[model samples]
Target: MRNAPLGALETAAALRRGEIDVRELAADSLDAARGVGAEVGAFAHVLEELTREQARTAAEGIEDARRGGTLDELGQRSPLWGVPMPIKDLTQVAGQPFEAGSMALRGNIATVTDGVAQRLLDAGTLTVGKTSTPEFGMPCYTEPATGAPARTPWDLRRTAGGSSGGAAAAVASGVVPIAHGSDGGGSVRIPAACCGIVGIKPSRGVVSPGPYSTEGMGLATDGVLSRSVRDAAVGLDLIAGPRDGDFMPRPRPPMSYLDSVGRAPGPLRIGVLLEPLAAKTDVHPAALRGVERAIELLHGLGHVTTPIPAPFTPQEWAAFMPLWSVGAASIPLEAQQEGELLELTRWLREQGQGYSGVDLAQALSGVQAIARRTGEAFSAYDVVLTPTLSGPPAFPGELQLPGGADDFGAQCAFTPWTSSWNMIGNAAMSVPLHREEIDGTELPFGIQLGGTRPGEEALLLALAAQLEELDPWPLVREPSAA
Candidate 1:
């Protein structure tokens, strides 16, 4: 279990150094997952033999590298090697089944892993299994119709924020050091905030969404959830790049994101946003206190912290709902109709049904305008920070719809802070900055850092690494007294 707690980079080093056998590591991880998965509901599919086989192959390659006096094919024998990792159920791994967290495509299996998953394998990552998500990733809360809701390891009665809820719960509970997560409107960040880990949504095109997808219509990008910021960065480094054919590739980083995290961001001017530009609800007092504590931490770290009012109107925020509905339209229709779709998915699809192509185009153009406006707004600052969620984690059943037109109302109630960055097409991360006092329960609070449109590689990680040193967040401690 101690070895199992190692981060991605550390696990790789131990593997390449031959200090630990990859097979044993894989067995340990699988054992831990089996023991804990039932309690936390973190996995949708667990592949025991497949993981051992992959780990054995990595061990052989590492041994050969030692004999040849050269690094393995994964390049430099990086720190992620031999580490068992989970892919969020939304992503496709070659020869694995991908349900997109719905029963509609219950029998559907993938033929080839996407580029991101391939790159992780190339980096010597051993696949453990697929984590859970809500139906087609429709809601911020993960209470799917088919499987048990992905519960927080800290409190089973509460919901693990979604749609990356399973991934966040897995990492937070030490099932794995890190796991893949995608954000088509805060899927990664919302769950990360709820589970108390680091979840980053890369800027549009920063990471490839195809060989399979063009875009989630500017509402989605792929990234990861991890207990540590560095683990998240290294995972991104393995997968961030342009595929053979892409409609819009993100501007290349001058260097690897892993390298960027090590460099200190010179004293920064950080602007704190207490209110979400789009949400009608105000942030809770505890969340506000978390922001205040982070500001103090930033001041101690030699950065200037200032409170700034954002320049967007409520009408502008209201206008983007249709664009989100268009994304609702984007979920493969087959996936939507699969086995009784969840309440949230049925609700979003109905919203999508009302929109025409012209309506979608108008929504796209409007989102682009907001992106332009937000880019200008951040021109005066180095980074903008805000709480990841407006309130603490919600309990199971607190966010469900009444199974009709009210589904739209349910979605609005479920997610309040995560969709705006997707509309602006900016990279945003939910860093676990603080915990709550009640029951000494870990209420993971997020500090959202968004950079200028194309400046994602430099700004997002730089700020994250800085915060990593300033206010290192602890794991959302499991409640049992060991």
Candidate 2:
């Protein structure tokens, strides 16, 4: 049981039956990770000793709870009890050093634990260790110059999408059922689409980032990437509480996200947008095919579909581009000057350095107005479905910083859809609903589904549950042990 890719629920069940002890599970996971992780490049740091300590403590505490009459027969004290999961290197887990996939931040250890990390601990999930990310989590491909570039389990040559590439790789490789990820732009969904998993970027403030967060940027959100919909739902519940001293709180959902999964999505009037906001970028055949397939699946599930032409123009995209440059530029110069910042970091910082402050303010204000404009478009439908990534998994180093302005220019061209949702601070997800034809080589291609503000759990997961029943990408076989 410990060797299998059991979900949070299944693990709890096995623990109740004594099929495997928490210690045995932790040890097996560590061994399996050591054996298979090298091939997939899923983990940045594997904490064997720390994981064992956590498992040992969890086992003792469960036993104590049994004796204390507080634990159930299933050992299900919480939705996440006894599950093995990985925290993305971007989030600070106390007592652990966070490299964030950059040499610049090497040896940077967290003196304090963050709210999300503490919440996972409180909910009884055993974190194995930190997964990888690109430098400052700045790119959609995880080929950080410093750390190991995380690759997809399906095709080793292809990328596991970044900046949450490490977490996505860990899940795809079956190192864990689910892993923590932060999505500023498409960090969560891009890799999830590339690796064939579920990535949910909840509405801003759905999961708090307090004591260290600035309010209302609409740029970043904390979430998870998981093998199954239920796994993501379970993890969200554990970490969804409001943190101390937060300015904006996610409106409390009336029910748990797990409960939302099995509920039928009913007949949703979905508006399909075939073209991205670009004037002339080629939509990958695989990506278009994926959207077509998802449309069929959703229609079979009884959802009404209407094809809507691209409502926003490239002019609007021009309005949005400066924000990306501004964000890229906002990388602290001190880090670049002092820390061992990667080439991409230094390049982005240099690019950002040229923007005027008024330019940033204008771009930000335009983005907010665009969000409102897009929200009005969404008012016409229950949901909108589109290809998650414009193409299938990019080959390793394909998205590295290109010489001249063309490098950043090309990146913006490739990933046009994901950032728009981030701009609006809506709940968006990439679901592994289809696999594109990549010759004989197989990699997951998925569809991006976006919900209106604060309707993330209802719009995305409910549909995801329906689709999961139609075509499930259950944990695939792990890489053969060497």
Candidate 3:
């Protein structure tokens, strides 16, 4: 079977040239999922029958388009036509299992397709399966009570960070060329960093959260995880746009994100911050080394680098937690079903329940104020750089054990720098750049580049593309001789 050894765009080109067929691509992806994906528990459900049906339909459509002499136009409209990508379990696909990694929602099937899923489908990409996530996407690690833990392919003992952990694992392990993910407080970037892949969390409203917007707080948005920056850019182009019911729809960029990749983002002013902002944990030496290496690379690329203090404050973090708890509390669950929630999720829900409407209003206002101030402070530079996580990948159960407040704290400490961009609605990306050997296993470390202004994703993509060219990351994990 011809697997996804090529990037998403390359795979699409091959499909258009008749070098590969949709059925062959789907079969390869499915085969990989049943192998490495099963080994790492990357999926909550593998839609084998659904994938086969979709592949058949897609192949027929491609043939019809070719015969009608509209193939080029169709390819232009759907850049990823005939490619295979998986949606995260947090998203609902009509007629598919929609278990968001919780025993409470076991056997629950979605009756509608979310806006993000619809956009991906409209782009001509088939959904091979639903990737695993934490319960209600609450934690930074994916150890759901309902299924196997999503472990990093680099080391099966280490966690593939969540709540987009499985998405990262799938892409990094060559199950698919790219996958859909969502970011709320570093969900996408954290897992991408852990698994040694690229993750792009676009600015708020870039991708619609329609039909049933989660939490309605605007902290989370759909994103893309892939092995290369260009692939992530193409994935973003496929799904990014304002839907009719979107509350905050940003204008589309003049140039598509794919067009922005590799373009010269003229020597940008880059601010580097090595300190942890939201969490109290100290940055690990390995993480620091990653940042230092990134700084050297940026300097070599002619970008001006300056040391900057953590732009966020403890007061901002204090304000942000209540808002997060409010989201957790808002999750629909019956009293009996609440017991099915993980300890950390339950604790967060309880914390949310404690806040009055007035308290929520106050918290929202505080967050908005902090966002404005933080944005103003960041205006001095084009992009801010930091380590994606405070440390390397955590072993399974390392962060969740001793659950409750401790679990939340452990997650925050691990992903110390990624949430600030989410708070301010700016674009952020995790680019794998460094590796370190720990306990006889070599693990990847990612450095983050966050755009200073909202809707500046093009700039970040350009910079990431340059970095990718300079130090290309492996498209898939090296095969093990087990």
How would you encode candidate 1's per-residue C-alpha lDDT over 1-482 as one tens digit per residue? 12236777777777777788999888887886777765677887787877988898888878788888775554454558778778888888877878877778676788888778887777778889888888777778887655767877667777778888888888888888889988877899988888888888887788887787677576788888888888888888777888767767875687877788988885888778776665566677778887888788788878898888765765677667777666776666664363467656666667877998898888888878877887788777777778888777777665765774555454454455567788777778888887785456656667677665564755677777888887787754573321
Worst 10 residues of 3 by lDDT: 473-482
Tens digit per residue, CA lDDT, model 2, 206-281: 8888655555455888888988888888777777767667776776589888888878876998989877774347
Clashes of each: 4, 2, 0
RMSD values, in order shown: 2.5, 2.6, 1.9
Highest lDDT model number: 3
Candidate 3 vs. truth: CA RMSD?
1.9
Off by over 4 Å in 3: 1-4, 479-482
How high is each candidate's TM-score?
0.93, 0.93, 0.97
Query: Candidates 1 and 3: which is better by lDDT?
Result: 3
* Pairs that clash in candidate 2: 104-340, 329-352
Q: Considering lDDT, which of the candidate structures 2 and 3 is the better prediction for this target?
A: 3
